[model samples]
Target chain A: MANDVFAKSLLTRRQALALGASAALAGALPRGALAADEKVTLWHGWTGADNTTALNGVIDTFNKGGKGVTVEPTGYDWDTLFSKWVVSSAGGRAPDLVLFHITELPEFATRKVIRPIDDVVASSGLDLSQVPDAGRTGVTFDGKVYAAPLDVHPLGFYYNVDMVQEAGLDPAKPPKTGEEFLEWAKKLTVKDASGKVTRYGFELPNTWATARWIWFSLMYQNGGTFLDDKGLAAVDSEASQKALQYLVDLINVHGVTNPEVGGNKGEDAFASKQVAMKFIGPWEVNLRMAQKMNFMTAQLPVFGAKPAVWANSHCMAVSKQPNEDKLAADGTFMKWFFDNFAAPATTVGIIPQSKAVRENAAFTGTEQYKYFKSFVDDLPNIVYEPLIPQYLSVFSFDKPTPLVTNLQAALSGSKPVPDALKAMKEGLDAQLKKG
Target chain B: MTSVASQPAGRSKARRASAQEGGAVRSGMTLAAYLFLSPYLALFIAFMLLPTLAAVGISFMRWDILGTPEFIGLDNYRQIFADPLFLTAIKNTFYFVFLTAIPMVVLGLALAMLLDQKLKGTAFVRTVVFLPYVVMVSTVGILWGWLFDKGTGLVNYYLTAIGIEPIAWLKDPHWSMPALAITTVWWTVNTNMIIFLAALQDISEELHDAATLDGAGPWQRFVYITLPLLRPAMALVTALTIINGWRVFGQAYVMTQGGPEASTFVIVQYIYLTAFQNFEMGPAAAAGVVLLLITLVFSLAQMKLMKAI
Candidate 1:
């Protein structure tokens, strides 16, 4: 009878162990095989030191909140990320979220690679009014919000204080008008005994993308339009011609900048004190700070009838999700992303699109922020790249964009401005037709 | 009589058995060889042949990568012919080939002849000459770009020191092609030199002795004997140089980016831009097909000429 009882006890013990094993597996499933947390993948092209740090901080904070959503971020260079996005979208393997330039929103939206986020915005009760007018317009297409505006970076004046002081100009007050700018440039320019320019007073980028942006800003400041009523090329208009002439004169006539060292070299010249002033995006603030260079920011001098600067925004967009659950998770993440937009703006040295962020002490306390306050006050005058889907094909530096090619020829003094402008119009029209 | 018939039947059965055993062994060997080759064959079909065939099909469609491809039927080809940039690209490609190929052949032969002489450090000389060929094209391009920079370049500084004004080697449209050609020749001449050196080594030394005895001068001996024997190597090198010249992309892409005004824009750059940047797969495929045909024609013509020479 004792042997029988012992066998029964052994059987009961085995059964209990089996039940415990199953229960333990069920308990571990949430952390392992059957993760209950929603996985959100984000693809971006933010490789700048500060930009990456800011992005990682936002992601880390979100992940640590234990919101049942894990964010996976992938970073690529700008060109590579764009190509990957294209291929992935076509292959139906796109990430849950993507960060793109506001300029690219129209194309992405029209191609259906990204979904409209109107419902998410309304559900989250997010105030869209905080976004700058230009940022809002940039991310909107066909009466719908396609992306959440993150930050606006505009072309502004960056000058070396030492260089300015050496040129006999007050470092505190920079050139505010076209005539004063020209006079200061002439005074600051230095030449060696061989008549070669050793130090340029002002530097303009020779590359197509940057040169085109500067040209566009100048045109807008002069009340010029890139497209007519029918959305056709209007590069031959009088205002555009004047802008082109002004750019040409900077190199060929005024001789303040050298055409040979025009692209990235011009930016380097400013950093290395080879030039007194340069017009570049606001991101240069952090870059110069990292270099430990003494530089200051100011609004671009009024070279035309009005004050205008070229600006673009980086925006957050949701890719086409596979299911309602994923979509809701993406929407939740995007809402949180915009709510905490100030983190990136303060860390990355970009002007905040959100009014609340702009007013936040985190942004207003920085010396760079104080210097860029004038640019912020001039926000209403900023001009954006055209929102047309064909804009990239017309202006991309990677491809042979006719406008850029012709502009290069003109800027390099290879062709007359009128002839280049005519060619640019013709080429732009052809490209538009092809599209 | 029964024994004789049985003997013949037994021989026939032995022959049949031997033939069956040999056939089985041969079949088994072939199966094993195929198994070994299957991996390479699978990769080639998947990566090369399939993509090429797909490209041909895609050339007939108007696909912008984002949307489904719509069959357009030769419109891409028609557009390429009418496009001025395509024409310019073709012209530039031809110019590059013309400028680079002949110099590579002549310089390669000259260098090989010099290096073939019994001299100290021939091994070192060979390694030095072939070094650029192994260096990465992008690295060479960047190094040369700095060397040719307008303001602070070593080349410009030397030129200015010599009382010649600094030339805008990369900025000027006319000079950009020549600059690129120089870089290409410097990078590629080693391959041809190695081939020529091998061919020179293979030529019998007794012929030169005999020619010397026959009152032939060094130049005459080279022209009569060495040149004729080196024809095969020259033919191969000429074809390779021409193909390499036509396939030039990296130097121009990294150094000048087909500027100051698309002056260095070659056919391959046009195709790359069309496909990746513009996302026009059809036009890019059309450009690729055209480039392939052009390269094939040039190679065949050069081969025939080399054979005749």
Candidate 2:
């Protein structure tokens, strides 16, 4: 009923006229809102317990809000969802809505299976002022918006308070420079009687974006973009190599992080206090909070010339199905989900991107906000992976793909750093040539 | 349990029915064979034969899964051949085959021969050795992943206890493939063992007795007599082991995911990446065809070598 009231008071022109206010924000509703009934299928890769519950709650509320749209949601792991969505799209049986990383928008857009929602958003008089500029820009390709931005997930610097203080470093004053970071991490590293590392200062888990996120931040701080303007690989430059070599040294030369990796992943090591400090993302933040860790979020250090950290956003997109009803439902459901997302997001500690939601006293009054404040504050320094179609697979933790393994190889002291970079450069150039 | 109980019952009933129709032997048998074979034939055409034929055709084309296919005339094959990663995958796969197949065949024969010595707990040992084969590949991979952990794993703990330095089993490119090979051999060596065990039990006591009567020592008699008889079974296990080695996917997929540095990135992993993950069906199909030819040539050569030996 909240959405029905929302639809009446803000989405439709009739209610605005009756309320004697200008119909400035209520020119038209999407066609699905005007439909008798439509069931919209939505797929996303958010299967974590809290995320699942929160998302299901959001979907449930949206369905009962008298929007004439019923969204049936499915959850899968990211890789499975990606391959399945591609095949499903090729077969002309794609779901009405899909949640995708903003970086993936280009590939889907290039396929022409998902349409730009900018014109529809404009015609329907949907409010856009609340969405962040990064959120807005991330979804737009060639001046056309492809998705409604949901949340931006930046890597938050997670540190164990007990360990930091034990090492005589102030937890409040997190390291600000690469030199300071090394000194602090060296101090934090603990050794046993026989010379085995009892506790690591920090661990760089060689999976997913744990390593890539830091590498990206370091690259940006050193004034290096992953890809140059011409869409060719640029990470082989001196700045990028300097950044990568630093990460490699942490495992090899520094003696802070061990040559051998962490117990499961970086998060597990951090959560269990085997590692004192490391970078973690929002997905782990909620889970870590639930586990009641004595940890805090801080800004990632300035490793090179300036401040930077890696981030990406999850966005909801509409499919370009020929059927008007389904397409309209996709739009209607996406808009509704975008608007009403704050409740579910706040419940599970997803940093709400909408300005109106972020500024709301209702949201500001929550406990999760305190933990999320640092990431929100650091949004200005966030750099997303370059919009390349191969970015996901190329840098994915899983197999046969080039970048992540090569990244691991360099860090684990398996391949020479120069050889690893050369491999990545060649793969990137090949992908670009195919394009 | 139901499947196990019902299978023999169904086979015996079919045999009884065939016995009753024995008077109409040749004509009836021809019709009956066709009727019984049709289901398998249909399935073979639809799933295996048709897809294999399509893959062969697709190897010569250019298709991005979502896009229309274009006949590029061996371009995909040329691309695969030129790819350094494909070469890496080939090298890694051969490395895996050497690590896994050799141990699977050798250790299996040794274990079976030992069991044939009528050692105490032979039944228990056989069951224990065969247990892992019954477990799913994914489960075995996950279990071994924990055991092979770099920091706190059992493998490292045991290594350190003996004063050897801890090795990064899953995370180091140098050691990751060996780790995968160990896991694979542990999981499926039982298949080769069971095959050899059946063949070993078929060997009569008379050969050993005759050799003893001729004054041949135990080692000589076993080598000259038992080994000669075991050649057929050895060739079978060797061929199967080599073929299975070429088809190694689930072990690498589950444990290393073909990495630390793609040191364990086997051929099937590459095919999976190109076919599904990257959606380049043409190159993936080409790689698959290449894998088939390699496996066929390698298996035949392996069997012939075993026969000559």
Candidate 3:
């Protein structure tokens, strides 16, 4: 019904688009006719205070760059924006540019709603060589570059500095291996006389997909992937099972984590010193800063064989346009964005994907950078979202789905770890069959 | 109950009523009646009927709304029945209704009976009890969520103050549904109270006095007189609460988000996620249609119950 209403609205908007395009050629109506004035509209999900301010700073500079192209950006939270994009693109009228993670490209590109940026990267004057291999690979799908690489935000280990120092552990050095992490957790955990926990060492996020992200990082480190070469379920393999069992043990066997905490509530728990350590993304930097708390972030400890942490990049993608002029104009702005996003992005508290910005003294010299320097150092070791379109159907943030829900089922002790793994395997297999 | 003899009498009566205003104006009045109903009729058709018909039509097809819709017949319905989460959602919804509807009616009547007496501060107490009903569901959800929080919540503070252990009200699967039920009952029970109170007030004081004069006790009088008299109001409250129970979405969504292991996941949330999140429009539509049918059957049964009363 929502799509039907959007489709109905698109009918009028199509005629409006036609009228606007021709009118631009006719004469200048405010922002239309400058002979070469390229107008690009952007839809993004950066409504956070720091991110939005940083974004606005970037846009204001670009709009005033005298490039003969004026850019307009609209902000919504990702969930609503994605739904709107699905409906609008189906009606053959999507935004000129969309800002999202590369993982979302499959959901759009499989239906040809979005276009490849391969043709535009050089055309838009972006230095593709400056972007890292992981950055570029994460954006590629079906042998085509789907989006311009942006910043990488990996799952970070946040801990209370005061609490860690008081626990007789060096604040400068954090845990680096699974065994060390467990030892540190046990050392940091505080309990009362009657066997009640006064402060938890870790917060096991049983309600949201952050814990799932941690599990994914484990799978990657343990040499597992979502599927095998023939596109079959490899998620229930020993690599994956062994990885999740460690986190499960933290809840059931070790009793170090606060099992009752939801996904985002751990931040509050961290602020109040109820929990000493939590694994989440680098976006948490701004939150703790606002609270003026003594906290710092480090790279997630290796839970498996090699070093890997769940990470993804926020990118700029172009929608399929009806005319070449719109696409070209969008490309022009997108190129400018990749070239200039680095400096402003540092203040936004994300790891720079561009090698040029990251190596600069100005980039690494910020007072805030000290807290997340591990993210900068561990950028290359990060593992991005699994490049499957229907993957979101299996696991989603904050919502109940097969994978996230079952993982929580295990963590909550409602189901055995192996049985939960089997349920997720079956769920993924069923979704793959549907596709 | 109309027989063949009643049909001619009805026609003659309508004719006489129309004829008293004279022949010239009768046709115009009928035309005016249609003119008056046109706006509402047009809105109902445009806003309600067409969308409903389109939903049912779409239920039979597998449309992602991005590509062409394929005619899949009853595959979506089959999938919904086979989906284990749908069964859980249905069971959770029923749990919510049972925990809410009957308890709300009984508690509402109990409060109404207390308020019906002309005690001092009756108006103040009535206003206090009814204040939460006017507050929004989302606000109530957030407020109650804080109250029910396991750590620093007022609920836990009081629970442990007198030597009771604090329960994880929203995080435990066993307690999430009851917590939502408590929030819902506190939010909307005043509607049931008002309905029962109106029925109680409509009962004349003379009847109770007569019962007392006839040597009947207050409890006996309530059983023999007030209880039977409140039957129609009870039917209305029961039907309304049941319908509202089946439609419970906002509280569970705002507070628990159908969590503590999806124990509070309701059918509406399932339908929503199926359509929007997974983009399985056919299955979502099928779930929606199933909900419509379930609600319709219950509504019809309630109507029959009302008529029997």
Candidate 4:
């Protein structure tokens, strides 16, 4: 009887231990009841130091509130992010959220990697009507919104206040017209004994992307369009030719700008006071602020018939998900983000799309608000790139297009303007046909 | 426990058991050898062989990485022939090969001959010459880009200082290719130099001494003895340089971006643009196959020629 009792006790102990171990394991697993706290992964291409800091700050604030949703952010350079996003989407391993250029919406939407956010927007009580028309239009395709636009960043004219004073010009009153701008450029130009320009009067970027933007802006200012009524390339029109000639003349005939100044080199030159004035995007505000340079922003001078500038927006997109709970969580997070993005947008040095955010006293009271206000007021003059899936292929440096290449040739004085435009039109037409 | 005299059959049985045991040990060793090789074999089959086979199959299909691949035989190849950019890429690649290969081989041989002699700082000099080969290609391209910059570049700065006009080394179509070729030769000639140095050391010094006693000049000795013996290494250097020249991408991609008008665009750049940028994987794979066949043909021809010589 004693041995039988001992054996039964041992069996009881083993059974209890096994049950305890299994209970511990069930608690440790990532699924089941514990999965109510879903972690959402967000991938972005914001490499600017200020932009990254602001984004992280927002995420921290959100996470500290003990919300059930946790946002995990991953950052990459623009090119790397784009390629990885494509690969991941194709492999069905896309992140929960992705930030992309508004120009890339059509491509991603057509591929069905990102889903329409109409239901999410409706359920979240988000006011899509409050967003800027350009931003709203940029993210919409086939009558459905594919992304949530955060901001609109456009190119503006930046000038050195000290340089303007030294040139006997009013620092507060920048040139308003093309002729006046030319005179200012001539006066600001400085030359040494050997006739080498020590300080350029005005700088125009010669990089492919910047050059293309400037060209498109000039074309738009002249009341020309990239595509005609039938949606074919009309870049070789008379207005475009005139714009191209004017840009080329700025380099060859006027000689106020350096022909060799291309890419970010011109921006660096302007920052170091080697160039007195430059036409660049609003991102320069952060850079100049960091450098503590005496600089100010103005609307781009009327070079053609109107006051138009090239602009693009960064939009938030949600990758397609099958789980209803996860989708609802993403929608909630996005709604919260839109409601509380003004402070982060200010830190990012961009003009926020929210009308209320733009009019907020906190944003307007900042030192750079004078410039930001000007850009916001000039929103009506914004010209965006063509909203097509092939926009990137035609304009990005990864794929060479005759338009970019020929324009570069004309800018470098290697090919005539007429011939370059002819080639560009033919190439664009062929690319469009292929599509 | 039975004695052999008591049970004679036990001795034969023990022998048979020993033989069987030996056979089992051999099989075990064979299994261990395969286990050791399995890791490498798995990686090779997964990464190299399977991808190659997939590429070959994809060459005949229209794949854009978004949808299912549609088999469209010979269309991709036909498109390649009709494309002018592909033709330009081929022409530029051949031009780059002509510019890079001969100079690399000749300069490498000359440098090797000079450094093979017993001299002070020979090791330091050899290291200095070979140092560039170890640096990354992207770094070399960037360095050369700064050196060739038109406004603030060292080359243009020095030229203007001496009353010479500053040349647009990167911006001008006429000068960009030569500029790129110079940078490439500076970066890669060191590899061939090391190869030539090894071959030079392998040549018997007794032959040189014998030729000297016979009143043969240095040039004649090199032509008759060293040159013939160095033929194998020459063939290798030639083949490698040609292949490397054809594969040029980073230099042009970084420095000029295949401009002032695609003057520096090369074959590999074309393939990359077609594949990733244009998302036309079918034509890109076809271009890759063409490059492979060309390299194979050239390598075989070079080997044959070198053997005959």
Candidate 5:
């Protein structure tokens, strides 16, 4: 009897509302209060234990909150995700949301596959004031924001505190200047009876991603630029040569480190404590902590010229959708992502780019948090690789050959500094032309 | 008159029945036959012909991923000649081909000859010998990298035990190519060994017996009869091994990543880096066209020699 009465009332109300547009408008006025069911598929390149913990934390928070939005995350390895994204973009099957390296956004922005988030940012009234200035502009292409900042990962010096103490050096007073660092390295070098290096002072991974960063950081610290104003290869300058020559001398003249460790199993050597120092990114600190190694982080040593670092950022962006249905879901999902997911992910040590969250009192009073916050502070002084479609070419595995060959030649006492730099210049020029 | 009319009627009816039977037999070619062959033809046209033609067409245009392709006929080709990396890649490719192919053929043939004798546990030996070929190329490459690791590798450990300094197998420019060659030999010798073994079994025992009766030595028999009979198989194996060696990528890619100063960087690896990493499809396509021509020339030469042999 009661149900019949309610049904009759509902029918009369609906009929009355349909009879008047004004009544319908009043009924639909509170759209924001009546949250719509939204679902989004987030594609990312973090799959392993790290991603598991981080992703689950964020998802659980979003589910518990009465936000009426659902986020489904799919994870793949970096290379696999990149290739899949390319194929999906061409096939018009892109995911609602994606996480990509900031360096890669320029190419996609050129193709217009990413939905520019400026209007979204504007309409949402997101306050981007406290986010690092460098992180903000790293994702910008042609004065347009293509991606929302996620995190900045910069290379920093990682030292074994135990080894530093054992070498009779002050662990708290870590090397602050270039000369001091050289002295510390000399003290840390341990040799066997046959003059073979038993424990190296420092081990630098010789891949382009790593070795080039080391060279670039040193060059920048010495007030050098990799490219000139016109964006030509300018690595043959005196500052670059000095920076590269220091690396060569560290291996050959100093003989404090083995050249073998540079290319083959350098990370293993660092992990195994065969090397006392390694210049790596903040991510390695997380890895080392997971491995239960007693390590401490410090900024890159000062060279008395400039204080700059090499860094890259992971940016989140909305992919282009083929229809309005997906576009609406994508918008809702992006809003929910920064409002909710960004908080806990930053809690787990991923540098959150939200102005509100990074400055939250929640992140301010923790010991582990202190380690990463310093990195975030220094991120503004860093530089990202220039945005070019062929940007990866100038810094690819093959492109490093001329540089590595020259370094090796110089170390082996086969070539002078001028000749080595000249060879690299010619090789880079040829590659740029052919490219 | 009645007998003649009956005979003509009988013969006409018989001819009509035979014509009906022939028409039924001719109806056997149905749509299913075409359907059965469609899959293979579709694959061939889509994956082989279309991409091949597209690559050739794209060789004349400058295309990056973002922009539209602009036609610049023969510019990519001109750049190829002017490019020093292309020439270096070609040299590296030939070096790889010679270094990998010679040892692979010789070692595979030797293993086959050794196993062909009536020895105990021959089947197990053959299976064990062919195991590496069954392994994935990337796995083999990584395994070789581990085996030749300078500091902690078993090879270096043994060398140190025998009072020798550890060699930087993949990290030194001089030894990097050799390390890659060793890995290639390990990856490929098993396939060549199987081919040689099959060919060895097919050789006539009567000729060997006659040669033995004529007091020919083992070396003499091998040189004269066995090798001559194996010439055709040898040519085919050499052609395949040469092609495989020139296209050596998985080893260099997985092990050193064409590193230690690009000593192990071959043409295919260079082309892959150019096309995918650089995203310069036009020049990469042109480089591929050059590689195709080189392979065609070499394969034709092999075919001619095989015919002469």
Candidate 6:
């Protein structure tokens, strides 16, 4: 087996072109035989300071677990990672372990690039008691676990305490309704004499991620589903349109926030204090909450319905190896890493998958940790982004998502809410039909 | 031709052994020739040629990345024409080509002419203008994004200084195409200008002097002699720009993101999103085949019109 593994590596360098072609074919096929000691190569889209922190955190735990395995790590940016992953998968040289966006997993799993982990999980007997049930369902595909949950990073509403106070609102207990929030946003929103905005109430993003986040939170709160059980675009209903219209009103008619707020990133605007309040992922907890500026955290504000927040989980999956022994070892490494290592590190800004780590004493004492822990129970209540293979296409190109087309119309008052929703529905239907 | 070919009996034999001196002769294959050509030919076949062939095959089938490709002859192409988005992509691509290519060639030629004269530090001036061409696409896109950023952008700042209201260059559908055109031209003109400059220099000074003596004005000489001679370069640059303009992805990816109401969406960005983002490689491949055919025909037409072939 060792000789076979050695030969595989040697052959890989000698015939790069042939290997690439063969690998692409093999990637989509059933698992082949294994080498005795499999070295699982893990590629992640984490880099820079955060990437270093994540890499060191995972590597330390994996190495210390004493599983008699080796894991090689490579990191690139998000888009590049996807592009490389696809090309590599087609070429048959993909990594053993990969960390992809939760939204992207459905398509990748369908393509059979990553394997199901049900057998590995059941054999390893990893406890699932502490992990959120919502997160588990998010990574599960076709009734099998193809990925292990690392953490759920939900958007936390970070507010400037100074602005909140000046607006006659309690920083401890934020607005409970859309009207109250709007009132406070208006009061906190500062403008110069000529009506040029000196400070914005909220910085909206004209990108898919932001628009989807806002639209989902509101629609869920207003009792709407983005897609029906049949996987059709269902956001054109009255409730959904109303929710979308409210966001449009905030920009065009309400006059509370800058109409051009979606021009740049909302989080940056909030961090720079150009905006008083903004919805941002929990990853920013370390960056903003630790700052000297007086700030407070709250659940995403309620509009019409119950309190529901948007959430996505980061997942760890073993990359498929050519040899069978290596596959088993890769599985063992995956089980060991998820069971032991990934959970604790995730608590810093992420909710861990290990049921044991959820209420661990390590997380119980910190103030921010306590705030984050409160939402752990809300995991089941949290919504997942679209899990379809064509999900990214829908966001990036399908014109229905306000991030691409309706945003300018919404901002410029060229297209009304109904027209935008209609456009979105038509575009989404076409894409879904194409599938 | 026959006499030239007849002189190399011994030379052809040795050249056959060395693989250096024969045009039509089967030379003894040199180890170096094989060594140099092997890697490129292998890569070309594996990456470029095979994929191109595969794309043609895939275009006839119905497949997404996840599932096996089921053959459905011409169905993908038929569906492509039926799909409104693909049609829109075609229109948007042509719109982008016209918006970018025309201004690029005209501005590039004008700039070449302006800098063609005797001037102090002409080399320095040429380098400065062409610098943007060498910068990474991401950097160029991000810089333009910042410069065109609504409210706070330098462009807006200057416009407002003159009492004109700020324009949301990337956020308005009416304005997005124009904004993208301006940016595309700014990043690409330097290369074309350099090419035009070289072509301009190749024009005989004696001809210009003769035309001047005949009392032909600057525009007349340019129209009669310079423009006619520059056609080959112009044709080449225009064809290249058409291809490049159709593949405008990075700018859209970075700046408007095919946004401001799908005003800046181009074919390549659509193809990328379709394949990688959608995991629909079949459609993406089909889109590429369509683009390849269009570009080939257009390029052929260009060559024919310019009589380059």
On DockQ, the leading prediction is 3
* C-alpha DockQ of every model: 0.38, 0.32, 0.39, 0.29, 0.22, 0.27
User: Model 2, residue B87: what's the lDDT?
Assistant: 92
Stretches of model 3 off by over 4 angstroms after superposition: A1-39, A262-267, A342-348, A359-365, B1-41, B111-140, B194-229, B306-309
Best by lDDT: 1
Total clashes, candidate 5? 0
Rank by TM-score (best first): 3, 1, 2, 4, 5, 6
For model 3 chain B, where is the 10-residue window of minimal lDDT?
B1-10
In model 4 chain A, which range of ten residues has the least summed lDDT? A1-10
By the DockQ metric, which is better: model 1 or model 6?
1
Give the winner by DockQ: 3 or 5: 3
Off by over 4 Å in 5: A1-39, A47-49, A56-84, A124-126, A264-267, A321-325, A339-350, A355-374, A398-415, A423-435, B1-41, B65-68, B117-120, B204-217
**Model 4: how far is B120 from its true place, Å?**
4.1
Winner of 2 and 5 under lDDT: 2
Runs of candidate 1 with Cα error greater than 4 angstroms are: A1-36, A48-54, A124-126, A264-267, A322-324, A346-349, A366-375, B1-40, B109-138, B193-229
Encode model 3's per-residue lDDT on B47-149: one tens digit a residue: 9899888889889999987879999999999999999889888899989988998789999999889999999999999999999988987688878877887
Give the least accurate 10-residue stretch of model 1 chain A, judged by summed lDDT.
Answer: A1-10
lDDT (tens digit, per residue) of candidate 6 on B1-309:
787599679976776666544543434446667878999999999999998999888888776654578988877777668866778778888888878888888999999998898999888999899998888877877787777766557888899899998887776677778888898899899888989999999999999999999999999999999999999899988888878887787877777677666777778877877676666667788899989988888788877877853
lDDT score of residue A287 within candidate 2: 72
Model 5, CA-based lDDT = 0.74
Which has the higher DockQ value, candidate number 4 or candidate number 6? 4
Error of 2 at A173 (Å): 2.6
- State the displacement of the C-alpha of residue A224, model 3, in Å, after optimal TM-score superposition: 2.7
